[model samples]
Target chain A: MLIRRPAGVVFAAGLLVIAGGTAGLLLTRHSTPALRPPPAGVAALPVPTGPIVAPPQEQLDKPAPPVAKPVSLIIPLIGVQTKLVTLGLNADGTLQVPSTTAVAGWYTGSPRPGAIGPAIIVGHIDSVTGPGVFFRLSELRPGDHVYVRRADGTTVEFRVTAVQTYLKDKFPTEAVYGATPDAELRLITCGGVFDAATGHYLSNVVVYGTEVD
Target chain B: MRIVKFQLTRWRVTVLLAFLALLVGIPAVSSSAAAATTTGYVALGNLSQTPSPVDVYLYSSGNSSPQLVEPDVAYGTILPYTAVSPGSYSVKMRTAGSSASSTPVWSVNLTVKAGGSYIVVPLRTSAQAGSLQVIDNNLTTPSGKAFVRVIQADLNQQKVTFHCSCAKGTAGDIVTGAAPGTVSPQAAIPAGPWTMTATGPGGVGSLYVPLTAGQVHTEIVISGPDNSILIENVLDAAGAGVAPVGGVSTGFGGTASHGSGVPLPWLALIGAGILVTLASGLRLRRRRLTAKG
Candidate 1:
């Protein structure tokens, strides 16, 4: 018995595929929005005057030693240990990624990993075949450890402070690359769905770390 | 009869609209001007061991008179940031409700420059008494993160190492060799409840602080004669929990900002760091609370 509606069967199967894909996309997407503004009267103080003692800010020491360039990255938690290649802005002013996805790259514009300011490193999650260098980046948790070897034969260890993900359209630029008072490290990678049309990932995964000195 | 009841004519309506527009536009103009004026910030915290309250006096430089500003600040308490005009100022602490004529317990002078923020805490130990543990709280508050510093103002725990032995990346000595009346440098950590330990020579005291995103905070450490430590987390600046947009052109590699030959990402990141926080209702970055380098 032949029911001659092959086109109808093909259309129904397409619909099911789309329905399941949509459900999966919604289930896996990150939902947290950008930071919300705190309520009023919560930001700062009222009128001034306090106990007649000394000013506490004076206790800080701002001096720092000379910085050394980063040579390699070591994230033992994720089994990532690779030499770092310097990255710069493309002519279009976007940060350049490494030509290959197997090795990670460090953004040359940022300070070195052991420096006083923030140093940034980026990698890919995957390519057409197997897992990329930062495939396990999103699996890192707070209190994890990542190390960077410097040109001066010193290794600076960094502790994970936070792990966050953001939509590429709403990526947190300041949160990932802002100037800090102490030595810090930032790791970046692409995550979420791959857009066949755009040839890019839809989200960015960022990891923040502090020096363990 | 209907025409007699009608009040607003076209001409009259036009005049009323003009007046309302002027009223609305005036505030917009004035608020923009006010945002341009840069002022300094000063936050005060009480870290003494005594139960008696203390009064804080902030006298303008060169003035000898006692001008009471903050009164009855209890131990382990930190007040919000006080917006201050940029200038030299001398602050004094007195016993609560004590007369201005009475002898002051401690005094210190500090310069408040435009856009600077400072935290001042008093020490109660005889060795460091009358001294302040100040940590310059002028750091950028990126979205989704909090900036923090520790003030080792405890009297009994003279020298201590503050450790964050948590399961997360904060598991290490955040501050080392923090002598009494000293403060630690700023550290950026995730926003949440963080448990830390102050390990001194005699005992180990526990501290806990709850922090939110987009603000600067200070954890004041104090101890009684029994060596029991108390920690008070205080807000220094409300950067208003807002993140600065635009950096590194991460997703914009295909956008017009990239192809347009814009000197971006580098300039964009700097702009983001200098962004004035709009969380003004919380007395946030609206006061032009700039950090000193």
Candidate 2:
């Protein structure tokens, strides 16, 4: 007669084998999948619409100097080139635009060059009609370089340190403009996923740079 | 001969007298003709025998450019040696070498008399450690109101205290505005280099305060309290407070006696829950395997 294994041992062995098989199957099923390339021709898309409604007298006025002419801006790492404009307080005490029309410039009311204050520079990421200057501002990364040339022929260079976004209501005004000991630069533009419901941009993109040289 | 000599001597004496009278009369006439002018001086800061260098400038409504009396002078140093006419003047002070980089620490306006000496002391001092009391006089209803208090203590005892007081209703109101409970002296605290803590009726809201002298600074937050409580340094000029100053508000709509509670991040809690569940599942599987073996 053939030797017969105990029923308990046989059952235990059968269960162990089943458990191992199930664990293996699960491990295989839950493995991460490889990333696939985006579909072709996906880069092209319609421009985003923003909330600022044009006034009836929307005729473009003479373009103001991009930031005060005395200051020259250059970002070596990011390949950014622009001028500064002087900004002031809006009628409602909000940040004033350099010009009524779309343009880039430094806020005149802001701190002067080489002064220890928040030097602000604003640019249009995209015009209502299409992409304007600073269209690729969102692509800038930390360690990118920026240079500011003053009228006195002296140039001050800055390095990208941080980039952040905040809702219009939650912008830290004092922290951005209040007195600081070091020379800093702040570049502001609209950012975040565009929302169709609100005419206004969902968030503001602020790029902070510190004087490097 | 005697008569002639005596007459000549008398004439000489009369001429000398006339000359003296003319000299005295000319000064009297000129003094009466001109407008009266007075002189005054404005002394900046506490006048110390050995004054520290204090910048002094003269600002007058009459003049467009403020005259720099002493570009930088010691505490007791006098500036614009000339008397300042009657008018209002503002005295400003900054630590030496402070410019656009460093903001002025003290500024005060003084009304000076036409001919008087005005002594000004721009007290700029730091508070070490002391009890601060904030009394809210806005008691119109019976509901209680919550206020946030930030305390900066040495050795990292940064704490946020919450206090609540009931609104004193009018004697006429029989229902609402009853006397509320005694406000709590402190709020929930966490490990902190805690520079600031803001308390509201809903919970402790956003907070920001600068560290000073290696000590943490505290803030009182009132949620939705439109009116801000003015914290001033009584020892300094009128309306002067510490640097990097801030205020908090009590929230709107609640019974008013609410306090800003300690907030726990939802993401952290969710993560913890997930971790616990995963651990429990692993433990159960191991136990089952051991039991079977």
Candidate 3:
């Protein structure tokens, strides 16, 4: 048997739903900027008390070799071969994306490919019209070969190690940019659900690789 | 004719003695004041377990007398810094209480550049073999910034990670996998107070370094009780090309007035040793002649 609700009860329930939604919108607006500065309790402490017995200045250590710029990128498994462009840090300190959707970009701030640290490359998964470069980047598997041609006329090969997708707000900056004992590479692109209201993707897909002999 | 022959032999002996005297006197007469103007500093540390209380001496190639720079320096202890002429030096390590003429257990030669600073570390490879490690100081940093390079000096400890103590995002790792005697690349950071934590075998050790603007530093790894790892803060020079004008003198703990041509005691000792050895040789030769007659 179908039960009929009173008009007054139905109206009150609708009002309650609207109030709950308004509260959720307020919470989301307040917490959008997730990255916050450290609290006062965790502030940097003062230096120790005593004489500063530092060694005297002398000649600098031997200069490190200059890193070569990457000219092109090739991923055999995904049949991706495209010319590369240079990218730099944005005004907000975030990594800048390449202008074109078909080609990838190597971050200038990161160590170059084959250098003794992790180098970063970023591309777009899609554009306003259609699918863009690195659209199938998340499909890459372990042991896939990634080749990068350098301006110095040498090619560096890397093997994919891991693939992970993380929310944009939960990005691991240090792991991607930190120093390493050997040469490494990071391929990044946008992925996951796209919000029409915000006009942005919710997460990012990252592929980690290490240089092969 | 016999008198003539005897007089000729006497003249020959006099000539030989004179030549010996010249050889001994030349180094003694060389101006040591000029050498001090281009001098550098060297600090000696005894990190070896074989010779617990060791005495160290520094000598050049042509110099016969060795200057006792470290007198009975115990294991895991570093003697104060000493001013040395900028040149190649051979270091001789002997057991404590050994005589001045005793044979040294270990010896190694190293070169110090002019106006440069260095640390000489004597390490124990095993019960049988030991070696001396020389570390050049890198004191240059970006303007209004401070630089730090962490090193793993204790061979017993495997590896260590040096980073800010607060949290992950505060700053990245200053150094990673700092092996024994291996220096990390310099990380130029903001000039301020920093609490660094070192995580390694057994446990973690931390240190607080107050980095002044335009200064550089190195934090060396040390072994604490029960195989724990610790860090010892060592200040690097002010900068590579920038000399400290009125601050603490370069090298260990120098208080000598700059530009003053103060005579080093070691220079005098070398001169005395040379003269004594030459005089004794001449006396022995004369005695041999008397016995033969």
True contacts kept of each: 0.03, 0.00, 0.00
The order of the candidates by TM-score, greatest first, is 1, 3, 2
True-vs-predicted CA distance for residue A99, candidate 3, Å: 54
lDDT of 2 by residue, B178-222 (tens): 111111222222212222323322334343322111111123222
Model 3 TM-score is 0.38
Residues B60-154 of candidate 3: C-alpha lDDT, one tens digit per residue: 76687976556887655654346577788888888988886788877788897764667676765445655777767644446456667776656
The candidate, 1 or 3, that scores higher on DockQ is: 1
Query: What local lDDT does model 3 show for residue B230?
Result: 66
Pairs of residues at least 3 apart in sequence or in different chains that clash in candidate 3: A54-B235, A55-B235, A56-B237, A57-B237, B81-B252
Show model 1 residue runs off by greater than 4 Å. Answer: A1-213, B1-37, B50-52, B64-67, B124-130, B142-144, B165-171, B224-226, B240-242, B247-293
Whole-model lDDT, model 3: 0.59
Task: Give residue B278's error in model 1 in angstroms.
Answer: 52
> Among these predicted structures, which one has the highest lDDT?
1
A107-166 per-residue lDDT for model 1 (tens digits): 776666765456889887766555677876877887887878777666777878777766
Model 3, residue B132: distance off in Å is 0.1
- The 10 consecutive residues of candidate 2 chain B with the worst lDDT sum are B232-241
Quote the lDDT for B283 in model 2. 45
lDDT of 1 by residue, B61-167 (tens): 98887443788877766664566779988877788999976777767888987657776767655553456555566657655667777778776776788876443
lDDT of 2: 0.38
